[model samples]
Target: MEVAIAAAAVVAMGTGNRVLYKLALVPLREYPFFLAQFATFGYVVVYFSILYLRYQAGIVTDEMLSLPQKPFLVVGLLEAFAAAAGMAAGAVLSGASIPILSQTYLVWQLLLSAIFLKRRYRINEIAGCFLVTVGVIITVASGSGTSASFKSTGILWPLLMIISFFLQAADTVLKEIIFLDASKKLKCGSVDLFVVNSYGSAYQALFMCLLLPFLSKLWGVPFRVLPTYIKDGAACFLNMGSISGCEGAPLLPLLFVLVNMGFNISLLHLLKISSAVISSLASTFSVPLSIYAFTLPLPYIGVASSLPPGFVAGAAVLTAGLLLYSLPQARHFGNTFSQQK
Candidate 1:
């Protein structure tokens, strides 16, 4: 019952994360890099604050904090790059298509698990992967010519978004490796999620600071003007300054950050309590819901946007793929991966 409840929370928060992100971007449309930096640096502060509180409660111990930082460093680096690519692409990609493209993360996760964990997948799992690919093709093709969302940006950004998912998958797998290695180092054979979140976020923020120049360049904001740009973004986010187009302002961005933070913590908590497969399934369940959310009459968006052409067909196929892939994992719960035969 606890796992079920947690999984449900994961789904709800994940859905909010996806939708709120797009909405938040609307107000910060001119400052995607600012949003990205805000999230990265904010995670560092929020995570460490929680870490401290957990330590005071004796939930997190010295040993967990003392574990080798190397793994967390790599996790940070991967996440930094992933954030860069994802934010760049997400700035242009439609909200609905973002979730659709994110489906590829599952495919990448499967491939990474096979290579790193020496796992063997069943025939059905392979079929599920194929279907996921087909569904993505349908979604992209359906909107390519007609929808301004895709037509304006072309296919490059969407493909880059998919590649960002690949990097995110790799970061996730590396975190798993950290957890596995911690078993050998810690007497409890497990580490608190906050410990990982805190350290990884710290490292990510560090790298983000170092990469600021390049990141600014990538976002077409000159490094010299980044401070002013961030200042304007902050003012706009707060709705305090004379910045134009700050329609949604603090409320929208605040909700997005809070929801995003909750979603990450809940998903990680779910992973700790339940199996990774279950955790992933919970998050995956949010994709369709997020797609549908855009079709609603949400604030800042003015009119309720219509569903992207072929969305129903593509979503149905994608859901089928997810279920088919999950079937084998349901039968073999608790094992990180099935042994290669």
Candidate 2:
């Protein structure tokens, strides 16, 4: 039941993210510079405020805020940059051959955790990682398009997209470490889940605001880019709602936002209740599944066109790998059950 719930939550999050991106982030392209930031920060403030209130009520703790300042800030900035770049890249690459750039941060997290966090992976974990890689490779390599397209163009925009994907992966690992470490130290209940995420988002929003001028100057782009992106995002989210027959729905975005919040909270909770490996694996499954679900209807757009026989074959291979990876872990638990019996 818990697994079911977790999978459902992740699916909801994956679906919501794509929809919200389409509705919210794509429309704010025409707004003023600071106004875009204001909208973003405003949303963050509201989201985090709910978490803050929970903490103030003794439902969580201040220790959630006791993260190492430098690393946290750096990671936050990386996350913001990755997010902006990824969205922008997706927009630019929308009509291209490869639409979905499956940023498997879970795989990166597993590797980083093993190296830095001294995480010891069982055979099952190792197998799972292999499966994930195989699946991704199959999905990417076998799907379609020329090998040249897969090759890096050395162009600024595509390079940024690739960088964004990598940075987002790093950010996921950083987040998992920070939140998990904080929860262990604080020994708080699940409420800290809300508090920690809320703080992270708030911090990221502030950091993004601070970096705006530098980013604009560095890229020789107008500060207007920020508003334009925001408007674009907003319009995308609104359109998603409309397409889903949620037109003029007052709380749809809010609901979607909360669902996203729920996803993070659930992920944090899962990390506590289970191993990071398990959490990562579960999260990884959502990525391809989301692509499959969302792209099935619009088979002509983006990565959908590539969903030919080879893509399906690759997806199958990936699924087989996931199963292979789970076998050892399952056996270990099964042995424990047998001993008890």
Candidate 3:
């Protein structure tokens, strides 16, 4: 039962994340890039502030303020960069047959948890990791229906995608560490989770703004002042006219932003209810879900090309590996929770 609930939470979070990204974050069409960044940060701040206020009102504990400063900021920057780079790469290599590399983070998380956090896993857990790795390799190697055949000359783009995504996993591990530390120190219940996350978002927003000038110069674009960007963003937020030269904006993207916010909230709630390891593992399910989602005909990318029977067979084998890995952990988690109860 515990396993079922955990798995359900994972699946729900995964689905929510997909919806959020597709619906919310993708919308805001006419805003400056920096404005979008601020919006993202503002959303986080609002969410966290609500939690903190609740805590102060005796609805949650106050220890939420104990979040570590340095490590959290450092990890946040890494995560931000990874995210930005990966998004760019995904846009560039939409249907390329580069191995779906995000799961590499699972291995990194497991290792970091074991080494620095002193978290121990049974042999079965290790076995689960191995199976997941194999599954990833199989899934990638089999190639998706939409997958572009590998080209030696054009490999650099996909390779960069893999590297950025690997860094994303590393960021995930670091985030988990920060969250775990804050949780342990604050003991103010789940309220602290929201607070820490919100502050982290704020930090990332500031960091991005500061770095934007340099990035603009590098890309050979004129740098806009932060305040100017914010003013333009606020106008967009207020439903006023967009800045000059900006394309007309739509409401759908704003709706998507709300959806993304919900997704983040749901994810944090899951984290409050469960271990980071479980949350991380559950997130892996997203890759498969995303593949399935992208298979449909859409505005940006059309339906995936049909695959041969061999590819289908390979996919099944890969899925079997994933199931083999997760089953043991699920069973063990159930038994452990039962004993504790």
Best by TM-score: 1
Ranking of all candidate structures by their TM-score, best first: 1, 3, 2
Task: List lDDT for all candidates, in order.
Answer: 0.80, 0.57, 0.57
lDDT of 2 by residue, 1-341 (tens): 57657655665675666454344322332322333355457657776777768767876566655646665676668878876776566544532323334434555666777876788777755776777766655665554553556454436657667678678667666666766666566556333555545656666787777777655544335665755655544554455532343343324455545656566667666765555656666665655555566455432223443354455665676677667655643335644642210
Tell me which of candidates 1 and 3 scores higher on lDDT.
Answer: 1
Q: Mark the 10 consecutive residues where model 1 has the least summed lDDT.
A: 332-341
C-alpha RMSD for every candidate: 4.7, 5.9, 5.4
What TM-score, computed on C-alpha atoms, does each candidate reach?
Answer: 0.84, 0.70, 0.70
Best by lDDT: 1
lDDT of 3 by residue, 1-341 (tens): 66547556666657655644443323334444544565566676686778768777876554545445777687668766765666556555644343455555677677767877788877666676666556545554555543444453277767767677666666656666666665566555343556656766766766766666654443334575645655665665445674443322345445445556655665555555664566666666554555555555534233454443344454454555456555543335643643221
Per-residue error for 39 in candidate 2, Å, reads: 7.7
Tens-place lDDT per residue, model 1, 1-341, is 78879988998999899899989999898987788789889988999999999999999999998888888899888888888888789767876577667778877877887888576778877787667666655654565453566677898999999889998888877777677777777897889999989988888898888888978888889999988999998988888878999888889999999999999999878867654545666787776677679789888887785666877887788678766765634344486546331
What does the lDDT come to for candidate 2? 0.57
